[model samples]
Target: MNKGNEMAGPEKEILDGIATRSVYALGANAASTRYCFRVLRRFLGEGDVLELGPAEGLMTGLLQSTGRRITCVEGAEAFCLSLSARFPEVEVVQALFEEYRPDRQFGTIVMGHVLEHVEDPVAILKLAKGWLAPGGKLFAAVPNARSLHRQAGVIMGVLEAENALNDMDRRHGHRRVFDPESFRQAFLGAGLSIDFFGGYFLKPVSSGQIEANWSDAMLDAFMVLGERYPDIAGEIYVLASRPAP
Candidate 1:
């Protein structure tokens, strides 16, 4: 998000533009934008919602009609501006999530594709745990390192392992890749429990490959396989909640 720097120059503009373009790309990201909502549907509760790293607000915009007040903490200034302009009702805080202190806790916190980019995932997660009201849920999602495409890469010897960071991931600002165990460890160590955990999108190839070669109907079918084999899906999701008190 914002290349870990202040928003300025052509680089930030280019990066900010990616989200807008990606909305039209109908690739993995657009797919994620759609699928993540389904993941949220299983756990989203009534009351205020806090969203972290809502770059350009694809999901944020979607959440608006729920009639729940949405507050967003974004790392990119351009993103904050876009989100504000696109959805004026949302409270957009233009700061890194770790730095922004919440005035109050939320009934639901949705963090999507953010942990993989942050420096200290557990610290952020620990922060997430602190920000939840009792019985509230945290809807979190991340890319799966051991996705079927990566599995194929491993068998082809192009990838050393499932956890191997490919050029595309590095370019997209992914600091680490996660299989289910590693992903679960981060949340568990942060002192949270996942009430439900599963995968969403079964990506048999890279996003670009899928967009280029597969039909929309076929892609929809692949999503079903994720429910059966989550460990190898393109993205993993969990519905986490605070311990009853």
Candidate 2:
């Protein structure tokens, strides 16, 4: 993935740099979806996979190697074009997730940390639910608003001036932030049964670096400890099943 730094494009080059830096600075996002594969592999079998918001085909390409037919739907024209060029073996669809209509169903769908940016998570989940075959699984991850560090930071801010840039930034365009309960409720309303829900990391991140930032040592420490004690994780990953008849 570090090779992403060598890829070229004006905006994409910059974003790719950030993505690459994020990997080195924060223990590599490969860790982000590692558990998803760990959990999904048990139930996915030799089934089809659908991935939403595949910006640069990083994870899409990863899923393709599992020997399952993979469909990657992305709204960005440049990204979709680049993905098609880079991974000709995988099927890439160009469209917003909200508008995409698959001609077939899938046994497993993995959506990582994409809901908070959606205008209607429930609608999207329901759409995903419709795409799944009976007994299919939906794997979703989201940021946890009630993270331990966030609460502590709030209290600390009460005593003195805090950095304005450090605030929970909704302006750059995330529609909603979710706590565990609220997130679970949305999934349930979409007709998926929650199989598991837990946090993944517990480090403090200022808003500026929310996308990526950390010392290499701290990143390693967080990865080891968070896997051991997932309860204090700052983000949540849930594996939910479509209700069985």
Q: Which residue pairs in candidate 2 have backbone atoms (N, alpha carbon, C) closer than 3 angstroms, thus clashing?
A: 201-233, 201-234
lDDT of 2 by residue, 127-155 (tens): 99999877778888766666555666667
Best by lDDT: 1
Write model 1 residue lDDT over 1-245, tens digit each, in one string. 22233444553454454444434224668777776787687688877999998876778877887889999987666677778888888888866666677889999999988888777889999999999987889988998988999999999999999998897776666679988998888888898987888997888888878878988788877887787889888889877877665
Clashing pairs in 1: none
> Model 1, residue 233: displacement in angstroms?
1.2
Q: What lDDT does each candidate get?
A: 0.80, 0.64
Tell how far residue 108 is off in model 1, in angstroms.
0.7
Largest TM-score belongs to which candidate?
1
